[model samples]
Target: MAQMIAPVASLLFSVVLLLLGHGLQMTIVPLASLSLQFEGFMIGLAASAYFVGFVAGAIITPHVVVRAGHIRGFAVMVSSMSAAALLHPLVAEAEAWILFRFITGFCISGLYLIIESWLNEFADNSNRGLIMSVYIVVNYAAFTCGQLMATLTGPESFHLFAIASIIISVAVMPVAMTKAAQPAPIAIVKLDLRKVFKTSQAAIISALVIGMVVGSHISFAPIYAVQKGYDAMTQAPVFAAMLGLGGVISQWPLGRFSDRVDRRLVLMVISILGIFASISITLLDQADFLVFLIVGALIGAATQPAYSLAAAHGYDHASENGYVRMAAGLLVAFGLGSSIGPVVTSVLMQYVDIDALFLFPAVLLAVLVVYLAIRVMHKDAPVAENKDSFDFASTSATLGGVVSPELLNEEDRYVVVPDSWEPSEPEEDDTEEAASVEATDDADPTSADEAVAEDPLETKAKASA
Candidate 1:
């Protein structure tokens, strides 16, 4: 672990700082927006806007890196995010907040791309697994700490925004000072949703549903906590931390079990569990914050692994050569679902009850459980030989993170298939010639042997047929 950490320590430090500020803002924004008298739907729209930009950034940021190189791109993204963070407090209107959130999301996507790909460049097969594990640990730890930071300042003040901006600004120092050379340029990922869906319907559907569930949970759970009459300082951070803790503890075991069985079966079980957990949270007495915390952790445990399982399942069907494309497609699908989730949940809460936020996920998970149950009946699991080994993946990961060569097994490294290597259909004339040859062989074996000797092409065509 020390050996793995030595090579990318600077990059990891930058990631920790980046996630800390980003994590703090994740909760602070929704809470602050609520304090400013923004309605539930507006807050949801603001959150959805970030994901909208996230999807755009994942698709377009590679070109930014290609043009500017990793270090320069990293610097630019960090600066942009810092500026966006400061802008949030200056603007009071929901529309302005939405725009700033989108910018922040866009910059964050690029920043994560730069950091993850940089780490990938420094890792080799021997240390890649350890490196990725440490990365996940850092991710969970930093974000949880960030949520804790929210306790230091109330959402209505400027101090929290300043703190978020300063933290992001400080994150730039480690990367800028590092001696590491720029990594290879980011590759342009081509996404064909049709091809991706054909690859694994269960994986794609699960990605979308998980996106909706997580998006709502992250964006609105703080609001729900506030509605329950708990202060942001204690209840909100604890709520967020419990979710992170649940995810951190559950992912590895669930991922390992997924490797040994049909991933869809694991997914089906998760969906069913998530349905129960969501319903439990919705019906539980909100006055007892402890109970909410416990059930929220259960919700996290049930929902958090869905994305990773879905991704692994997708990879089981994807050709080794198309791993990057498949991963990118899943990210896009998840992003689309995330963009829709919060708005719908918020509207549900507006027209119904604040608890409808939890109910929204419950209904979605129920549908997913039913869908997976039906899918299980119709589709046999992929042959074990064809399955990809399960690796823990984060929903927060950018495209570069998902497709990093260092994270893949040696056999699964990105490969380019030649455009000219497509299979060709046999021509009618060739088929007819082969038929004639077969007829001759049936009629007279000796004559057929002589005919083959006369025409090598006939023999080759006959073999092809």
Candidate 2:
């Protein structure tokens, strides 16, 4: 175990430091927007920009890594991220912050790409799942720690942004000084939504819906807590932290439970749980902070792992060779939903009550529940033996859509050739062919006589050779 971990320990340490800064920044951004008196729509737009940058990073960062290499690319991204973090304080305008948010999103996605691809290099079929599980745990733990750090200073002050920048800058050290070998160049996954949807409609749609509901909630929850009279510096951070903590605690058990039963059944149950939790939050509008926090945690427990369950369900039907592509498609679906959710919810919050935050997700979750029920009734689940073992899914939850060749088996590690691509025939070289015959004749004086004596087919084979 120590042998396995030793190579990636610096990578993991970097992850902790990076996520600590990122988590704190995630908490600070919306709260800071609110302090700047930006409208709800503007706040949500800024949040959506981050995911847009993430998707953009998915497309562009691979080329960056390929050209500059991992360590250099990682350094570039970390510098951009640190600059972006500090820029939020200098340029308080919503529009400038939107651009900064996009930069932050792009850099963070690239960082995850470098880190995950490095981790994947040290992993094989025997231990890939365990390595990724540890990565996911570290991600959530670091992010949760960062979220809690919001209490160290107010979002309105310059200090929190500076702290976030400093922490993000410090993240560079472990990765820079690491002696582990760099992984292969990262390749962009050519997402085939059509193929993935054909594999499992329930999975793709569930990813979309989960992104819409969860993404919007994460962006707005701190604002909601503040509006509910909770202190932004104290109670709101705790509220945010509790939500992640709930997902952390329940994800493993939920994943294992789904392995035994139909995953669609599991999705339906969680969506229903999500609906109840949303309703509970509404009813507890006047309840104490602790009560609201508990309900918030319940909501996280119910909804956060649904994407993973849906992914597990998709894998149950996907060809083993196609897992990377399928996961990429799912992330695209989720990314689209993540990008769209905040804008719609923000508009609703601007026009309607602040409670529209929860109301919007409640409606989406109910829709997801109905959809899962239909899927359950329409098709049978994969047999127990056919079901893929559940691994913690990071597609939409953490990694964005950053799939790489490392995720594929060693023999299968190549750029995913598109289904539409076909091999072209090699052109014949008449001059080279004639030269080869001439050389063969010169090399063996009897070759011409032997050619005539040889079988006609043998002669043709020799000529071709």
TM-score winner: 2
Q: Write the residue-wise lDDT of candidate 2 on 1-465 in tens digits.
A: 777777788889998999999999999899988888998888888988888888777667777876777888999999999999999999989999889988988888778777776777787768766777787778888899999999998878899999999999999999889887666556455567788899999988988998888778778889988988899899888898887788777888998999899989888888888888888787775689889999999988898877778777877887877776676777677778888999999999889988888899999988988888888889999999998777663433643452322244423442331111111333465578777866776699775445323311100000000
lDDT agreement with native, every candidate: 0.74, 0.78
Give me the runs in candidate 2 sitting further than 4 Å from their true place. 393-406, 409-465
For every model in order, what is the number of clashing pairs? 0, 0
- Runs of candidate 1 with Cα error greater than 4 angstroms are 393-465
lDDT of 1 by residue, 204-320 (tens): 898888888878888888888888778876688678777767766787798889888998888889878888887777676645888888888898888877777887888788785
TM match of model 1 to true structure? 0.85
Model 1 lowest lDDT segment of ten: 456-465
